[model samples]
Target: MKKISEKIVRLRIVVIVLVFLITIGLGYFIPRLKVNPDVMSYLPKDDAVAMQFEDVGKRFGGNQTVIVGVKSDDIFTEKTLSLIRDITDSLRVTDGIRSVVSLTNIIDIREVDSVLTVSNLIDEYEIPSEPKDLDSIRQYTMSKDLYNGFIVSADSKMTMIAAKIEQEITETIDTNLTGKALMVYYADKYPGKMYEFEQDADTMKIKINKAAVADQIRDKLRTDFPDAELYFGGLSFMVQDIGDIIMHDIMLLGPIAFLFILMALYLGFRNFRGVFLPVLTVLIAIIWTLGLMAILGYEITLVSNVTPIILLAVGSAYTIHVVNRIGMEERNGGNYKENIVAALKYIIIPVFLAAVTTMIGFLSFIYGSYLTMIRDFGIFTAIGVVFSLILSLSFAPAVISYFPPKKRTKTEDKPEKGIIAAMLMFFYRLSVFRGKWVILAWIILAGVMTFGGFKLERRVDLLD
Candidate 1:
């Protein structure tokens, strides 16, 4: 260890250059990092519930359905009806849309010459223009159980356009299932599927990108009905919104956290090396971890979005310890090289032990969780901790050896009566005098937090 430290200091420039090149190379993967906010995709594939859910998706249509709600003072108005018609028409033609159900597209059952006839509520070429026409349409819609509450709101002031998106079928279908059986099933289930089957027998299995389809519908609604009060609800829209929000939070929170860390470090250390070296070490760890995730083809998920922040928080501690130890040793009369070696010898074992235990704690999540995102979070964070430990042991000491802390006289060794000092003294006295009470309070707080954590429910609804 001593020989390695000597070599590191002797080849400090080379070590620094190598570290820079490696970090830069890893940083290249930053742009390539994919963000996936689909909550369903995070479910463990081997989990029975997840497999069953996927099977359900495969048998039926995709789970990605978007409900677009349009509100107005009077939805029965000619203008409102016309806008609904236009929007429904546009959505029907949207790519990857399996089906669209709205006031305009929904089926209306009627007795035509004593024969039951089923047709679209609003014809493509015809829209309700008069008050009487809209009144009749509204009456018929309200009368139907399927349309009421599902498509048209009870109050009739708001209507929902439900669009079913088709997901891409990546797996091959059962080859044993004959086309004739599929055609018969389609004929009995969906009349429209009969025509599709007739057009192409292979059309029994269809593939479509549900997310892209949802994006198209959302874009159309935003572009064409900009003035309308549109509330998009459902799995697809929720997924998209969740993705956007996660990204926004990542962008907004990351810098804020960095600034806070910077301020805290600056105030504590009162020196550039003290603040800069620890931050830089943590930054490198974060970049390396994220880049590794990208290289491994793991998408950044909502759960894993906190990786950078976690790394920043956890990784900085070792560097701080190393920096302080080296500073203390130097101030106590050791030369730069000797202090660097001595600091490493004293701190490396504890730092490594702390890092290993923390990593083991994180790794427990990987073993315990059935969710991919949680497992990925565990793996990446553990990796980041490892990187921090390595850099703190190697690069940190190497760098600090070049910029040693100035020697302090005996007078400077005495604690100053500053605000920070006063606060520390107060805390020290409190801990000494009220140690038993403080411990009891902490235990009670921990118990309350644990009980509260168990009571907290998992929220799938992003809107809530």
Candidate 2:
């Protein structure tokens, strides 16, 4: 520890340049990172249900299903029928679809001119656009005993298309269709998810923002069918939606947390280096963790996405401790090199132990957790903790060696006794006078928490 601290002071320029280069290198990989939002992807491979589901998806098409609902004022109109025909055709050629069943292609057994005939309910290639033809087709579809709740609903309000195989048609909406309603189902097997990502021009990877594909279909529908409302559901769509939400959090929450931390550090330390150094430590740690994840072929999971904010909250403390020790050495009139070396030797061992213990706490999730993402969260967070310590020991002290703060006036060094300081002083005196009672109060609180833990119930949702 002594030798390392001496080198950090002796070669401060080299350390600063190396750290800058590394930070820039890691930052380059941040844009290429991806998010995985599927819940099933989090399940452990040893999970029996997941294994069975994977086998089934391989044998059939896929276990997951997509349901698209379309609503309009009237389902039997010439315009409405044409829209359904278009949607069915679009699904037929889409990747991962196994089959498609709609009014245009479903087989029908009907009495035509006093003789029974089996044929398609409507000509697949020719959808009726004329009013009389639309009316005639609706009547025929509604009159059949099998078509009432199968092809057309009991009431002619909603229409649905089924794709990728002839899936069971059951009573989806029990209520009679008063408003416009359309339903469609398409099931795909594993690895053939319905919302499979579209390739970029340069073949860059992307996450669940299936907007590339879904947007194309949605934009056309909105322009061509202004009167209809479209709704999407199913595993693939859920994953896509979750991906969007996680991206929003990653983009918005991390910066907000950083600003809050900056404000708090400024309030406490009242110096630029005090605030900047700690923030730099945590930020560089986060960048290193995320970049390492990308380089090692690990996609960000919903669980792993929280690492940045967690490291931001937890990792700053290591650097703060180093800065505090250096401040103490500075106030004693030590030179910059002497101050940094003395402070590092005094604080390095304790900070390293603190980081290791905290890392072990996070790593416990890896040894026992059933969710793969939970394990990933543990691994990356532990790595982030180590990175924070390394930065605190190396980058933080090296930077401090060159830019030791000016000795403050007596009043500035001793912060004013504001409301917060008043409260803190009160607590300090109370602790000194009534130390045993304070300890007893803490024990009582711990006992209450233990009792409460006994009454807690677990709620697990593996499917989510």
Cα shift from native, residue 389, model 2 (Å): 0.5
lDDT of 1 by residue, 1-464 (tens): 67766776778788788889989999998898977777887888889998999888767876678888899998878888888888888888776677788877677788999999998887746775777877887888889888778777889899988887765433233466665775576456434311223323344544443444566678878998889888888877777777788899889988988899899898788889989999999999898988898888888888889888888888999999999888877876757788788777788788889999999988989777877899888988999999999888878887887775666777877877777878989999989999999999999999999999999987655667
For all predicted structures, in order, the TM-scores are 0.86, 0.80
> In order, what lDDT does every prediction score?
0.80, 0.76
Please estimate how well model 1 matches the true structure, expressed as its whole-model Cα lDDT.
Answer: 0.80
Residue 418 in model 1: lDDT? 79
lDDT of 2 by residue, 1-464 (tens): 89878988888888889988998898888877878787776777878988887677657755555555566677777677777777777777654455667777788887889999999888857877788988898887888877788656777887666653211122233243222321112111213222332233423221222322343344545666566766665555666677788889889999999999999889877788899999999999999999988888788877888899999999999999999889988888857789889999899899999999999999999887888889989999999999999999989998887786687688876767887688888999989999999999999999999999999987865345
TM-score of 2: 0.80
